[model samples]
Target: MSSTTTEVLQRKPRNVAVNTNPEHGLHLVESDVPEPGPKDCLVHVRATGICGSDVHFWKHGKIGDMIVVGENGLGHESAGIVIKTGSEVTRFKPDVVFFSTPPYDGTLRRYHVHPEAWLHALPDRLSYEEGSLLEPLSVALAGIDRSNLRLGSALVICGAGPIGLVTLLAAHAAGAAPIVITDMDENRLQVAKKLLPRVRTVKVAREDAAKDLGTRIIETLGTEAELVLECTGVESSIQAGIYATRFGGSVFVIGVGKDFQNIPFMHLSSKEIDLRFQYRYHDTYPKAINLVNEGLIDLKPLVTHRYKLDDGVDAFATASTPGARAIKVQILDD
Candidate 1:
């Protein structure tokens, strides 16, 4: 072993933010740094972004069938430095900054053992926080790819949350024009407007009817949208996106909601609208990296809050809090 790797292993204690249980909540627990397997690389986690799914698991202890029965680390959008590589690993070596998403035993720790195949080399131009953002950007890219968005395509994004905002950035870069984003939070809407000055914003109340909101979106955009990116899994938002889309257009559902939802099947059938769903993402990291590296998408504005690794509980609290107005809360090492 190299002296640098040995030094890292000896000096760094793995302080992992674990979801112990719904009752006990998130806690920082110390564990010994793990060794790399034959196909694994030991990463010194640098920055980890708090995701909505992370919050979901933190609060409910499960997302559908994926449950946290015992203590589980909770972060997927993460970037780090490769400190040591396994004997069989050849794709990467020590000191290479990389971004990755591990299943449940996540990257929110000082030290992490990850499969070398899953790690993407983050460019020097992108910060660790920006590298962490590649995970969500990948989701946005998947949604856009499914939508078949074209140049000058009219688009409506339901929910101006982090996913919606990233979708907007990706869609805009892809040449989708006259985009309108809807949100219940005015602050989030304002953030969206600030991101794209030409993009329209709509604020809808929780009690607003889907059809009525749909009509308002059409009026705001001056025409039915060619594509609707349903970033909010809310029933009303889904229905609104369906109503706002033009005949034969597509509505891509990117958000995770309840197990079942009531849909206006007759209306959907009548319009001949194509309904699609996003199942996480596939083969998107390279594309996402290129988009950022080329300066086509700016992810820096999205990170609204930052905290040290030890203050992870507080970071999660701020992220889950609505009034905090945090778009992306990241926990950094050191």
Candidate 2:
């Protein structure tokens, strides 16, 4: 067996870790420590940001084609330190660490091994908590890129969750003015308002949202938006985004929703609204790190809750509960 396969097969059952499955929700379990392969590094996880997708998987056992089989580690938005480097891992020194992403066991554990290519050096100015945010920030950057947002452009963002709020911040950094954001949860919208006092917040329901939200966006901003970011992925919000956008504008879908959503394609075509979609992300980490280091974007306020690794269950519960007042829940390893 290869080093990777041997490591998984040889792990002791008493190693404390977080395990998730459809049957038992999330619970603390003892799992074997992972061994590093060539070009791999064993990292000691310090902080892991709980993302909406993690909550979705914990609650529903799947997000589209990605499913949790047996007992799976649950986290991707994480930062950690390199404790051991594989024989061929020259890219990362012992001082480096990185955030976790897909197709890898998550970082909600004491230690995990990942390829050196996925590793990025944690800036000296950032704490583990802040570093954990890089993954989400990168997603926001990708969405901003897809929108082709310009400075001082009128913009509307649907959904005020973590992704929505980050997009709002990214837009602000890119000089999007008079930004408006909407969500069904008033608490989340309130958080958005605090982030940018000038940002207009709209609370609208999916019930007849296409008409009501379009009108609300127009009335609030005094005109249709030049760029509409449909971050909610709700069918209704997608439709509202089409209606709320101005002629020749763009509607960027940043949120992951059902496989098939019913959108007003004919209306969007008629208005010459450009429909754009941003899948996860690509090559956004360096820029995200730069923006944070420059103090141009503040991610600290978004971390509303912190839980110890032992409290993984409660953390997921809090994240899943609507109106629980959690913007971002981070799981920390001491």
Q: How many Å off is the CA of 326 in candidate 1? A: 0.5
- Estimate, for each residue in 1-334, the C-alpha lDDT of model 1 and write its tens digit: 5787687577765556544464647898888888889989888888889989888877777776777776777887888888878999997643223332223577788888888888889778888889889889999999888778899999999999999999999999999889999999999999998999988998999899999999999999889999999998999999999999899988899998888899989988999999999877778889999999999999999999999998999999999999999999999995
Best by TM-score: 1
lDDT of 2 by residue, 99-133 (tens): 32234456778777878888878778888888888
TM-score of 2: 0.91
Per-prediction TM-score: 0.95, 0.91
Model 1 residue 15 lDDT score: 52
lDDT of 1: 0.86
**Lowest summed-lDDT stretch of 10 residues in model 2?**
93-102
